[model samples]
Target: MAPIDLNLLTALDALLAERSVTGAARRMGLSVSAMSRTLTRLRTATGDPLLVQAGRSLVPTPYAETLAERVHAVAQEARAVLGPASQAIDPLSLERTFTIRANEGFVALFAPAIITAIQQAAPHVRLRFAPKPDKAATPLRDGMIDLEIGTAGASAPEMRTQLLFRDRFVGVARRDHPLFAGPVTAERYAACAHVAASRRGAWTGPVDEGLHALGLRRRVIAIVPGFLDALAIARQSDLIALVPRSCCHRGGVATEGLQSFDLPVPTPELAICVMWHPRLDADPAHRWLRQKLMALCRMPA
Candidate 1:
C-alpha cells in the first residue's frame, strides 16, 4: 500500500471541521479552488467521501466524523513539538534520571548539596553517580553519563563545560605527625613518606617536579586510585596523603584524626568543572540541573 501524505491530515481535518472547501481555504490561506482540489486528494487518500451535500450545505460523512476530534488533537500536539522551548518547565512534574561521572572526592563534597537541591525542586528526579577511573569521553559520547564533574583535561572540542570551583592540593597526615611539630620546610616535607593519588597509578607528577626544583624529593611508599582512599590510609598511619582541599570535610582536612598543611613546594591550583555533551546544553531540564549544581558549588566555602 502507498504511504499516506501526513500533510494531508491537516487538510482533511480542516475539511471535516468546516464541511466547505471555501471555509477551509480561508482558514488555511488558500484559494477556494485549491482547497477543492486538496479535498479531492484527501478523499482519495482516506478512501472516504469525508463530506456530502445536505440541503445546500456540506456536512461531514460518518467516516469523517470519526476522525474529526482526534485529528485536531494530533495536529495541535505536532505544532507544540515543533515550537520554540522558550517557556520554562515545571520542576515538580519532571521525572528523569541523570548519571554523572566524577571522582570520589567530588562526590563526597558535592553529592549531599546536589541531592538536597534536586529533591526540594524536582521530587521525581533521581541521580546516579559513576566513579571516574579515568578522564575519557566515551561515556558522554555513548549517553552513559549525563554530566561529568572533575578537573577538566584534554577533551573533545564539542564537549560543554562550566567551572564549578577551584581546588588546591593539601598534604594530610595524622594530627601529630612530625611534619607539624615545626615550620614545614621543603627539605623536611620531602623527607617524609608520602601516599599519592593517581588514577593511572603513577607515583610522580607536578608535585614531585616542584619538589625536585627545590633540591628535594619525597618518597612515595604507596600509590592509590583516589584521594579518599589515600586519606583513609593517612588517617591511621604516619604516611602523608596528598589530596584536594575540597576532599576535606567541612572545608578542612582535619576531620577523622587527620591534619592538612599547605604544601611547601608550589602546586598548581585546579579548576573543577561540570561537563556535558553539547546535545543537552539547551534542554530545559538539563539547563536547570546545571544551574542548580553551579549555584550550590559557588556558595561561600
Candidate 2:
C-alpha cells in the first residue's frame, strides 16, 4: 500500500548488473555495510533472494535475471526524466567514447572526414568504428554501439533512423582491365569474372537481379565479406568489383590502381542511413554527434 522509494530502483539495477554486493557498493558509491542493508531492503520488497553465492562468486537468482533488463531500463528512464532539460554542452569540453558499426566501404570513404570533424570540435572525444557483420539490432538495444551506418534493413521498430546519403553501385576493375578499353554492355559485364561483396557470403545481389532481367548472369569468381576486400582483389587481378560509387573516390578503397564504370544493368540506388536507439533521441551529446555525421556525409566529395 506504500509508495516505493525511487532510489531503490537505481540500487536494484546496479546490484542485478554486478551480482556482487561489493561491486554494487562501488558502483553506487556506498560502503559495503550500506549496500548490504540496501540489499536486505531489496530482498524484503521483492520477496526474493535476488542474489545468491555460488562457489566464490555471486550469481543472480532466476527472478533477478528476469528483472535485470527491465530495472536497468527504468533507471535510465528515471535519470533522463529528472535530468536538466536543454543543458548546454560545450563540444570543446566533452569527453566521451562513441562506438559506431558500419561497413568497410563507409570506413574507407567517410570515416576520415567524420573523425577529423569530431576531433576539431571535441578533441577529447574518442570514436570506435566497429565492423557490421550482420544487421542484428542487439548491439544498439544493449547499448554496446552508439550508432549504425549502412543501408536500411530489418531493424527494431523503435529504432531512430536518419538518411545520410543516397548512392548507386558501380563496377570497378584494374585500370588497364579489358572492361574499360571498350564500352561496358550487359553481356560484356557478365562475361567478366566478378567479386561479390556480401557479409553473409551471398552470391546474388540487385546487380544479379538486373542481369537476370536481360537473361544474363555474371561469373562471380569470389565472394568477399566487404567492398574493401573485393576492391583489394580487383586491384591485383582481373576480377571485377561492384561497389558504391561514392566508395570509389580519392579517399576510398577504389582510389588507386582501379577504375569504375556505371553498372551496365540498372539497379536501385542505396539509401545509406545512420540508426540509433530511440533512448538516445533526446540526449544532447548524441544529438551533436549525429549532426556532425550527417554534415560530413552530406558534404560534397
Instruction: Give the per-residue lDDT of model 2 (tens digit) for 69-179.
Output: 999999999988887776579999999999999987788788888999999999999999998788999999999999999786657778999999988989999999998
Overall local distance difference test of candidate 2: 0.90
* Displacement of the residue 221 alpha carbon in candidate 1, Å: 1.1
**On a 0 to 100 scale, what is the lDDT of residue 136 in model 2?**
93
TM-score of each: 0.87, 0.72
The 0-to-1 C-alpha lDDT of every candidate, in the order given, reads: 0.85, 0.90
The window of 10 residues in a row where model 1 has the poorest summed lDDT is: 246-255
lDDT of 1 by residue, 62-120 (tens): 88888999999987776677678655988999999999888887777778888999999
Alpha-carbon runs more than 4 Å astray in model 1 = 1-6, 29-34, 85-87, 249-254
Clashing pairs in 1: none
